[model samples]
Target: MEKDILEVERKHLSNVIKECDEKHLLEVEDKFKLTYTYDAVGMGENRIPYEDVKRLSQSKALLEYSEREQKEILNHLKAYEFVKNEAKSTKVFDEEKLKDIHEILVEGIFQGGCYRNVNINIFGAAHQPPDHIKVYDRMAKFFRNLEQFKGNPLEKATYAHASIAKIHPFVDANGRLAKLVLNYFLIKEDFLPISIPLESRETYIAKLEKFKIEKDLTPLTNFFKDLLIKRYEEVLKELDI
Candidate 1:
């Protein structure tokens, strides 16, 4: 059943791209601006208004603000921009690439990409994150495991998303960066990027927590499958399919 849905989605996406010329393809990319905003809100506590986000994304330096709300919007926009550019790459995922994406995510806010040097706690969970000192080695093990992972594209990307969050390598922005990497893998495999909506934030976090506690990936993978299906359905609807 899932395979059937995936085949339909694959054809829908192919048709959309086939239907568009160069100019319309560029417009399609622009359509993701609203997507980025929703994704940012999904990962953030202080939500930016939709209009402000649309305006903020337009200005590189023409508009500036010192407020936390504005800063969150700007930072997320930067991270999404990195995702957009990286989606164009054919590069394989690695630690260096992870750091580069983290740098883009937290630029001007803090020195990012470097693994956390201090201990931290996850709210609402008792499982202690590995010592910051072990992050490098742990991350090495992660990529090694990824190389050994034998699964479909959605499974791999979903596992990547779960593992990155579990590792919590960076000082901050782990969630956002992990999701971006998730989409990176998905897009690289020609799958539509899946954005977990803000409305599902609680369930999303709970799914991650379930993975952390049970060491079972089924729940997380299932969550991702639903999101992926929803994402494909949205695009197919836009095409009036």
Candidate 2:
């Protein structure tokens, strides 16, 4: 029943988007980029303020933020830019593209685009990531299944997000990378990107862990679908539809 309701809402939103003029669509896109960028970065450990995110997004400098905060915010902005500009043109979803996003998000902080050579653990998570040696092979299969996945865009996007979290392909920024990959799939499929607010971090992590440990995607899929519906509602309100 809820799934049916989401399907109805999704179609209604899709139709509205189709009727939206170029300027209106651009306005919605711009708002989503700024808002989602702020939310995504805020979900991380650094927790940059919304004002700082706005300033940095516009290329304005803020002296109050530490070097790490400044770099993290800028990296998120750059990564979001990559998604906005390149998602549509991306013909294939593969390791290269995934690594590209990770690289942008960790340019100054870490070895961008490189897999971890040492094994790692997710703090407080019930699921331990695969061994470092298995990351490459697991990631290869992950990409293969992602490309061949026959589920609807929402399901596929959730899978893309959760699988990355499960595999923990990189040493850092895995959560952000997973969310970015989720948006990349959604945007490529002509869906609006969904943002998980910092407030929802606990529930989000729980749902992710459910998927990781139980291999059940229902909870995570429902979580993502609800967020997508909220995004569609926001865009519609912006358009006065």
Q: Candidate 1 has what TM-score?
A: 0.88
Q: Which parts of model 2 are misplaced by more than 4 Å? A: 1-3, 14-24
Give the per-residue lDDT digits (tens) of candidate 1, residues 6-111: 7677887788767666676556566665676556554756555666677766764324444655656667667767776777787778888888978877777789
Q: In model 2, which residue pairs have backbone atoms overlapping below 3 Å?
A: none
lDDT of each: 0.76, 0.85
**Alpha carbon lDDT of residue 33, candidate 1?**
56
lDDT of 1 at 20: 61
lDDT for model 1 comes to 0.76
Tens-digit per-residue lDDT, 74-122, candidate 2: 8887898897677889468778888999999998787899998889977
Estimate candidate 2's alpha-carbon lDDT, on a 0 to 1 scale: 0.85
